[model samples]
Target: MPLDAESEAIGTLLLDRGILSPDQLLTAEDHARDWGVSLVKVLLSRRWITSDQLYEQLSYHYDLPLVDLMEHRPDDTLIRKYDPRMMNDRMTVPIKESDGVLTVATARPGPETLLYVRKTYGPRVHMVIASHFDLSWSLQRAFREQHSHEAVFALAEIDPEMSAQQVITPPQILVLYLLLSIFLLGIAFAPVPTLIVLNVLLTVFYTGNFLFKAVLVWVGGAAQESSSRAIAAEAGLLRDEDLPTYTVLVPMFREPEVLPILTQALRNLDYPLAKLDIKIVLEEGDHETIEAARSLNLEGVFEIIRVPASHPQTKPKACNFALRYSQGDFLVIFDAEDKPEPDQLKKVVAAFNQSPDNTACIQCRLNYYNARENWLTRMFTLDYSLWFDLMLPGLERLKVPIPLGGTSNHFRMDVLRELNAWDPFNVTEDADLGIRLTQKGYRVGVIDSTTFEEANVSIPNWIRQRSRWIKGYMQTFLVHSRRPIHLWRSIGPAGVFGFVFFIGGTFLSGLLNPVFWAVFAIWMIFGEDIISPYFPLPVLYLSMLNLLAGNALLIYLTMVAPFRRRWTYLAPWGVTVIGYWVLMTIASYKALSQLVFNPFYWEKTQHGLSKHTANEVAEASADVEEAKG
Candidate 1:
């Protein structure tokens, strides 16, 4: 096997066919002369051609020298003996009867194939020749024909909206109207107690919520950092050879502009091509994204699963459809705008192997890739960093249910399937599913893997996205809290407290912050005597302490987030985030209104307006090429 003349001749053929560049051929020859390595290895190490490309080119170049199944035609006697259907459907190679043995010629020889052959021929078989390429092709062709339905089902739609008539009511609007009417009527009366009651309620609600948030952050932040370090350590131990199969499901709809970046990011993952199951889930009606997918002509490993036309167009619905065809034991979801760490999947696998069997989900840290895109993105990234890199891990350590981010959630296939997948009807199905998982006695852990996603930097865009998220959280709250006993039983006392502090507290704070700020402003503008009699000394002291502590905690949380990310320069923006919270309050009100009106309407967030430099693009491209190869 000392560089067979035929193989050398095939290398020359590859050069002539432009499969290997002139420089690659020269490098291959240089490596052979200098290091005594095979030209194939040299070429591979130099990143000239992929193994699959080399195999394909070599097999086709030396067509006759390579195994040729056409030359050894099946005998007419054997053909007559076996049914035509069996010959067509079953993968078999004919062998001539020999002295107490039958010598067969097969295209591929692997453990699975050998098992089948042994089962069929009673273990009295001898192999004359084995060609891996031919066997792979035959197997792929057979599988393509027989199980293409997997692909079809992966693209099918599963949403069906039921039309039910009920009395329509505008609760948020009605509440606001009632408040306005009371205020107007109070003007005719003293109007002093009304203002006092309102101030007291706002102060109590915001202060309580803020204190709860601060406590959760303090507890969760340490655990999240520790979990991240653990994940990174585990990732370091994984060899390229031991990398497990990973399925990346990116569900898209009318997002043609981001497809290029999305696919490119997936292509950059530090995983084997054979082990990567990158499925771009698209809607049947989303012709724009479909066309974008087709134009990429991405490698055979990249597949476009077209989710058939469905009633309620939702991301989880598309994911549910694709879940059926996923062959990977570990599944990770990435949003259209996400750029996940190359070894994130490996980290997930390592974490899963180390964790208990009940740990069914691993949530990866998420940050904005375009952190400096604008003031909005910067603040959004800070908030997200604190939530994922701090709050989530703390909840996990506390054994409380963790509300999942929109993407970068790695799930165990068995548990995911058992849960009947994501609820198509729930807008924030991921958040809902997190609660459901805890109820079913499954725990979710956090991994250190970070997924950089596109933050909504524009004010209007941010509002729309934030509003939808708040609305979904509201829906999740209602769905779970409809039965208080069930919630207490499933989550236990600690979890119930955690949920109220984190989810309910966040919502209440968002809704009440403006009111508190207004009271402070009014009191500052008016004389102290106007407010002093109504607001007692104890009440005033408590409110002031709460406000001071809450503001300090907000600043601390925001500043600490950047430190965790190793981007300390971003800490200055903690002052700006206060204004951002005011904006969130506005969005929360809009979201609350929409919850009763348009619960299922998806608020579209636009992207690709960030000022990414050429260097960033080149670096991203290089990452993509490495991942894809």
Candidate 2:
């Protein structure tokens, strides 16, 4: 159906003021009809005219005073009385009250908004025009404290068991104490036997971890092919108007240089621009990137959300704060240096459409664009390819809870909100949320789409990033394991083991590697006599077999990690992953220390450091210039 008559005049006004060319107007009008959106939205989405120009013309057409909410600030007291979310949804807020009449500022200065004002604020009311940006910013400012508090404490308050606010419960501490006491007592009374038993357990654990991973790779590699093609075909057949509004959240901190790469990548997505609600979520204090985004003069589809500084300054919290202003039906997060495949969103939508009703999230494979930048980058790429491309699909196939990758995990908006969004206190909130989703009776699906990011090229940078992830895994394990029976009942037996081998084994292997390596080195130097007492004949052979076979299986798995993406060159570098494990050991210790000392501290990974990113920035600049031309 056509918009009411006043909405049609928006295009006429744009054409009359020479802000939109005749061809541009015609194209926008056609999109408006096809996409079932208003002409003003189509024009804004096209970037043919600035928001200031369109809104200025709107003020003139509607005969309402144009007020800049930023300058003539809204009444905070009045805003606090009404629901911020309701105001945001209506795109209107009561700015001030004069005598008995209330002055309202609305971005949508239409009959609907006028009726809302009269109904909500009584008959004596005045309405003024404000840009959507101004209205959103004003709402954010008024509710800064409220939103910040909610972001930090929402999960903690509503569901304490799921929150990481309390790192370890008393019962968990008691279990740890009991286990430590037993180990100490056994070591004192029967040293040799205790060592033998410890060796046996560690060897068994090593065997289980590697075998589980190998099975995952085998299962995941085979599970996704035909479904991927089917999803792609369906995506190609999807109509533009049928696609739901997608919210892209790019949460950044002090990474202004690479902002263009992300924006350009988002623009390159095959989805309709008008159907995209992109938010560049930033900390209020990060004036650098905030200014950089404004300087870019992004189209109306992109909104800059300045998150208030709060405790546990993590990406999830920033996202939760930005979630309030989001109008999209689905949401996905991308990092500053990410370059996702153009059709990734479409693929995700198709995957969701084809999935079961309970599928709440769809995880896309993540790889590195600069995989060959350095040895560290190569190893990182292989690690990610194995995790996202193989292990995740395996988890999905086995009905195990798949820990979500850092980026490109599309979520059903209602489910995300229903779960109180993300746990701000958890450092690796993505993985934790994936597990939590499964426990909550929601399934997470995997798709074939890829989002290529710049891998960490520096060893120290990689360590910092890896350590935080490990720390998060620790938090997740402790949080879910607190209620073991509930977890077992919620996810079932297969999920429990997957949780153990996947989440538990990740950190445990790192912590145990150096100990076993030391034992192996000592045995090799002393001809096995030094530790012979602790390892009887059968146990010794089992230990050696676990060491050799486990290492070989892992190396083989890494070698084939990149085959799905045809990154064969990276396969050779997989042999050097032993060095990567050493780094992981170091990071694992760092992570353990942080978990004990500062669990919620997010060790920010510095982006735009690689030479590849520099090249991307240059290319992005050229693209901007060409578009301008």
Candidate 3:
């Protein structure tokens, strides 16, 4: 839709006054078209014209008074009559009243706000424009003190990970001791027998793990029914206004570079502006990122929530802090570097619409924007493709617990809260939440939509990121396995089997990869003749099958990961993941050391490390908008 006559006149007046030049106006108009937002939004976002300047022009053009609410306080009685939430949520403040007529100051004087004022405060309403900044400042000043608790999420008090850890009962501790004692006894008294037993057990574990994933790969490849497949067809059926209120929480750290593109991607979302409740969560201490967020001069739909400095400064903690203040029917999380496909939200709504009532969470696919940045990224892409594109769907299809990736997972607000939100102590809160959801009889699903993020392209950066993940996986395993029988009863046999295979298998792959590789090296040097006597015939056969078929099947899965994305050239080189596994093994050992000493330590992944910048992600977002246009 073109701008209304009044908005056009304001633009023309701004041009005439040289507040913003004609070239700026024309360029903003072009950008407005691309972003599917208003031209006023474009100009304001670019800082071509200040909010005060634009609103001043609007008030003059429309003959409405421009008021700054901070300068004029509302009647205490009148302010108490209406809900504080409504005023804050709508960016409106009741300024003055005469003869039962109320004058309201608002940043947005659109039909929605006007209708709300008229219906709630009676038809005698006078609407005046105000600078969005001043309106926000006034709202905070008037309401923040009374309800500061409502603004920040109380995560520090509820560290679910540690709480669960402290509750480990006597019986659970006894079980751990008994198992350890049994292993020690076997090793001390019967060394050769223990070696044979351990070798056979490990071989079976590897085999089952291999077969389980092989099934997922085959099933996923055969189905090829990704969540992205239906977005185009479903977009026509669902109007933007028909969608319920949606809140997207973006938890950013010191990522100054990606902020502009982040806002651009958000503005490009295919949702109604009034219903979009997007909160950019920033740490109060990070001046660089806070300034970056402030520079965007975002719309009323986007709010900057400053999180107080606290221990366990992690993303989940930040998100948990923002969770309560979010008033959305459905909510999702996005990273600072994420450039989600424009229709991703629509896809989540549709998926929720079609799913069973027990289906509470839907995880979207996450891929790297810098896939071709270097060798590290290419392997990261292949790894992600296998996990998100293939294995996750298969897990969901099999009615097993789906370990969620951090970004792009959507949830029902009530269900999320009922589960007590993310565990602030858990590093991989996404994965841990999936397990918790399934334990509570809620089903988690996989969607075909994707959010492209910046991949860690440097080896040290990759190791830091990978080690944190490994440490968390270890935490989750120990936390949940505190009561094994209860876990078995909750998820049933398949769930228990899957938990052991998936989580246990992942940790083992990193920790045991080097050990297995060393053994293989020794075996290769000495030949089977020297190694044959120590191994029984059955152990020898199982080991040989795992060495040949099991390892090969896994390598095959990585190779075909690119084929899932139709990146055929990359698929041919996926064989290089063998070396990638070595890196993971190294990180796994590091994670093991951390888990023993500093379990809650989160090695933050540095963003914007790739040669590619956020502009590439923004260009990709624009391309989607262009295709839709």
lDDT score, candidate 2, position 284: 93
lDDT, model 3, position 189: 96
lDDT of 1 by residue, 392-505 (tens): 877888888888988999998888877766766566778877877897799998877789887776798889888878877777776666556878998899898878777777
Tens-digit per-residue lDDT, 1-629, candidate 2 = 45547757887887888888899888887887777777877766866788988899999999999998878998888888998878987889888988988989887888888888898889999889999999999899888899999989999999999999999999999999999898899999988888888888988888889989999999999999899999999999988878898999999999999988988899899988889999999999999999999888788999999999888899989998999988888999998888999999999999999999999999998988888788899999999999998999999999999888888999999999999988999999999999999999999999999999999988888899999999999999999999999999999999999999999999999999999989888878887788889888898777877878889989999999899889899999999999999999999999999999999999999998888887899899788667655
Candidate whose TM-score is highest: 2
For candidate 2, give the lDDT.
0.91
Q: Which pairs of residues collide in model 2?
A: none
Worst 10 residues of 1 by lDDT: 159-168
TM-score of each: 0.72, 0.97, 0.80
What residue runs in model 1 are displaced by over 4 Å at the alpha carbon?
1-202, 224-230, 529-534, 613-629
Q: Roughly what TM-score does model 3 have, to 2 decimal places?
A: 0.80
**How large is the C-alpha RMSD of every model relative to the true structure?**
9.2, 1.5, 5.7
Model 1 clashing residue pairs (backbone) = 220-394, 267-628, 268-627
How well is each residue in 1-629 modelled by candidate 3, as lDDT tens digits?
Answer: 45555456666888888887778878766555544555565555544555677788778766789986667665655665667657766768786789888888877666677788788777898888887666655554455444344323332345343233343457667887998898899889987787788788888888999999988877766553644456446765886436788889999888877777787778777776546778888877899988877755565567777766665677877787666457689999998888898888888888887778998998989998788778888899999999988888878777778888888999999998777687766788898888888987999978778899888888998999998888778777777777677788888888888888888789887887776787789898988786666589988888889999988889889988878778776786677888898899989999999876776677888888666875655675565445334
Q: Which of 2 and 3 is ahead in lDDT?
A: 2
Better of 1 and 2 by lDDT: 2
Compute the lDDT of residue 360 as modeled in candidate 1.
87
Local distance difference test values of all predictions, in order: 0.69, 0.91, 0.76
The better-scoring model by TM-score among 1 and 3 is: 3
Cα lDDT, model 1, residue 506: 63
